[model samples]
Target: MTFVVGPVSVRTPASSANLGPGFDALGLALSLHDDLTAEVLESKGDERLEITVTGEGAEDVPRSGDHLVVRAMNATFDLLGERPAGLRLTCVNAIPHGRGLGSSAAAIVGGIVLARALVDGGADRLDDRAAFQLAVDLEGHPDNVAAAMFGGLTIAWIDGAAAEMQRLETTVETTVFVPPEAVSTERARGLLPETVPHRDAALNAGRAALLIAALTVAPEHLISATEDRIHQSYRAGAMPESYKLLRQLRVEGIPTIISGAGPTVLSFARGIAERAPQGWAVHELAVDVEGALVR
Candidate 1:
C-alpha cells in the first residue's frame, strides 16, 4: 500500500494501573497527555526514521528506529503488510517517565493511533480491541495500555494471546503525589515475592471486586474498596516514602493507593492539599474520557 495521507496527529492520555487490589487488572486514565505528529515525507532516498522530541525525556529518548513511538508505527505498518516509505515524527510529551504513570503506554498508543489515522485517511481504523491487543503485545501487559486506549476506568485481563478490556464510568476525583525520584517498573516488580499467601490473595480479590463497584456504583465504599494485599505491600521497600504517605492518608480516612508500580501515590480524596506531605508535587487530574485521539 502506498502512503497517501498528509500529516496525522495523535494525542494519548497517561494512565495509572493496578489501583491497589486489582494488580494488572484495573487501570485509570488521567488528563495528562503526550502529543505526536507524523508526516509521510517525500522520499529523499534516505530511509532512516527521524524523530524530534520535546518536553520530558527529550534528552534521553531515541531519535531513531529504537524509539518506542517509531517502533509502534513500524509495528502497525508490519501488521498491515506495508512498509512506510519514510516519515518525520514530532513529539510533545508532558507525562513523566518511570513514575508509574504509563508514559511508555501513551507513546505506543500515540504511535499506533497516528499510523492508523494516516492509513485510514483520517478515519480511526484502530478500534478499542485492536489497539488494546497491539499495545499489550508491545507493553507485555494490558492494564496501562487498556486505559490509554479506552480512557476512563478500565478492567483488563489477558486470555491466551488475546487481551480484553471493559471501560467503566467513574465520578471520583483524584489527586496524585509524585516524588522527584523515579522507581523503574522492573525495580518495583523485583521487590515482589514470587508467591503470595492464599488468605492475602482472597482478601485482595474481595477488595478488587468492591473497588470496581465503588468506582462505578457505590462511591461511599471507596475507603474500604482501595485496600490491597497483592503488590503494594510487597513493593513497599522499593519506595518507603510513598508507602508511608499511603499509610498516613488511609489513616486519615482517605482512599489511596500506590499509582501503578509506584514512587507516585494516588488518592481518591478531593481535598488532598492538606493531606499531602512535604516535597511532593500534587496534581489534581480528572478521568480522561477520550483516551487516544486522532486529530
Candidate 2:
C-alpha cells in the first residue's frame, strides 16, 4: 500500500513568445516563476482532487481540479498508466494568466514535473522530450513551452517527423509592462485571420530571420529587428494601448515589442533610465538561464 509521503514541489519560469515577426516560432523565458506543490497520501476512497491558490492573481484563480494544474495531473496519470492514489495540489502563482506571460504553460509544466517526481521517484526515468511534448499538447503551441523548458531564448519547429530546437543568447535587456486586466488567450487566437496576403507572409518571414540574426550577429540591429506585419497588427483591437505604447517607446529611443499575443508590452533598452516609459510598471530583467528548478 502506498503511504503518505512528503510533498513534491516544482517551479517553472514564465515565458514571452512571438517576439514580433517570429509569431509562434520565437520565445524567451523570463526571471519570474510559478511554484507548485503536490502531496501524495493513502486513499480512504477520497479520489477527488483538491487545490489551493495564493499570490499574484490567486483571488480570481479557480481552486478545483478543473484548473490547469489538476488537468495536467490527470494527464500525467493517464500517461503513467496508473491512477493517482490521491493528490492534493497547491499552486502559488506569481505569473498573471492571459497576459502573454505564459502563466498556463507554467502551471502545466509545474504539474508534470511534480507528477513525475511523485511517480518515478526522481527525474532519472522521465523523458524530457516527452514531457515537453505533453506541455505543447496542453499549450496548443511550442513557443512558450520551448522557452520554459530550455530557458533563455528558444526557437522551435517541427521538422517533418521530428522536432528541432535552437537556443540563442540575448545580450539586450527586456522590460515588461503587465496591466491590471487579463486578456484571454483564446480570444487573442480567435482574432487571427486564417490566411494572410503573400506579401505580408513574406514580410514576416524576412523580419523573423532578421530578428534572429540580430539577437546574435548584430545586437545593435535589434532596434529595427522587432518588426511585424502579421499577428501583432491584427491583435491591435484587443490591445490598442499596447500598440500605441510600443510606437511611443520607439520614438523615445527605446524599442518596444509586443510580448507574445500580448497585453504585456516589452521593451529592449540599454539601461534602466533609458527603458522606463512615461507610465508603466517597468521591470528590468535578464533571461532565466537556469531554467526551472526545485529544492
Candidate 3:
C-alpha cells in the first residue's frame, strides 16, 4: 500500500461523558477541538518520527514516539499492515488536559482518523465503524470515544466485549467552568464504592433515560433529568469546589452536572460565565454536530 503524499489534517471535538447519572454510558461532543496534521517524510538517517505539540498540555506531553497520538497512529498503521518510512506530526490543541474534557480520548480518536486519512484509499480499507471500535478498545471505554468519533450526543455500551453506540442530535447549550488545577480520573474513580443501593441505581436508570428526552426534545426537564445518585457525590471530596458549584447552580433552578470525573462543571443553561468560581476558566459551548472531520 502506498502512503498518501502531503499532509492530512483531522479536527476532533472535545467530549464530556456521563452527563450526570448515565455513568459510563452517555457523552456529548463539545465545540472545543484539537487539530492534528501529519505527513510522511523522506527516510534520512535514523530520525523515523518527529512530533510537535502546542496549546493545552503542550509543555507536559511527551514529544517521543510513545506520545498518545503517535502510539494511536502506530496502532492504526499496524492494523493496515503498512508503515511510512518517516513521519512528522503537529498538534494544535484547544482542549485542556486532565480536565474532565475527554482530552485523551480526543487524542486517540484524532490520531486514528489522521492515520487512516494518510493512507491512500484508507476510508475503503478501515471504515468509520472499524476506527471507532479501535478507538474504544484503545481508550478502554466507549462513551467519550463514541461522541468524539461520531459527534453530537452518544449513548455507548458494551455488548460482550464489543463497543456499540447510538448517536442523537441535541440543541442544548452548555457553559463549562474549568478549574485552575487538574483532577486525575484515576483518583476520582478510586473514591467510589464497589456497589450502590438498589434504589439509587433505579433512580439513576430512570433519570438517565429522561436525560435523553431532555437533551433532544424537552429542555424543560433538564434539571430533573440530570439528577444523579451514583458517582458524583461519592467522589465529591476529590473536587469540593466543583461539587459546590453544582449544588449552587441546581438550587438556582439551573441544570448542572460535574463534567466527566470532576473539577470541571457544566451547566445546560447559558449566560452563566459570571457564576464561575474565581481562578476558573469558563467557556459557553454548543454541541458539536460533527465529531471528527478530515481535511
> Cα lDDT of all candidates, in order?
0.88, 0.78, 0.94
Decreasing TM-score order of the candidates: 3, 1, 2
* Tens-place lDDT digits, model 1, residues 134-212: 8899999899999998899999998888999899999778999998888999999998888999999999999999999
Clashes of each: 0, 0, 0
Deviation of model 2 at 258, angstroms: 1.0
Clashes of 2: 0
Candidate 3 residues 142-232, lDDT tens each? 9999999999999999999888999999989999999999999999999999999999999999999999999999999999999999999
TM-score for all models, in order of appearance: 0.95, 0.90, 0.98
lDDT of 3: 0.94
Lowest lDDT sum, 10 consecutive residues, model 3, at 41-50
| Index of the highest-TM-score prediction | 3
Runs in model 1 deviating more than 4 A are 44-48, 121-127
Clashing pairs in 2: none
Global lDDT of model 1: 0.88
lDDT preference between candidates 1 and 2, better one:
1
Candidate 2 to truth, TM: 0.90
The deviation in Å at residue 199 for candidate 1 is 1.0
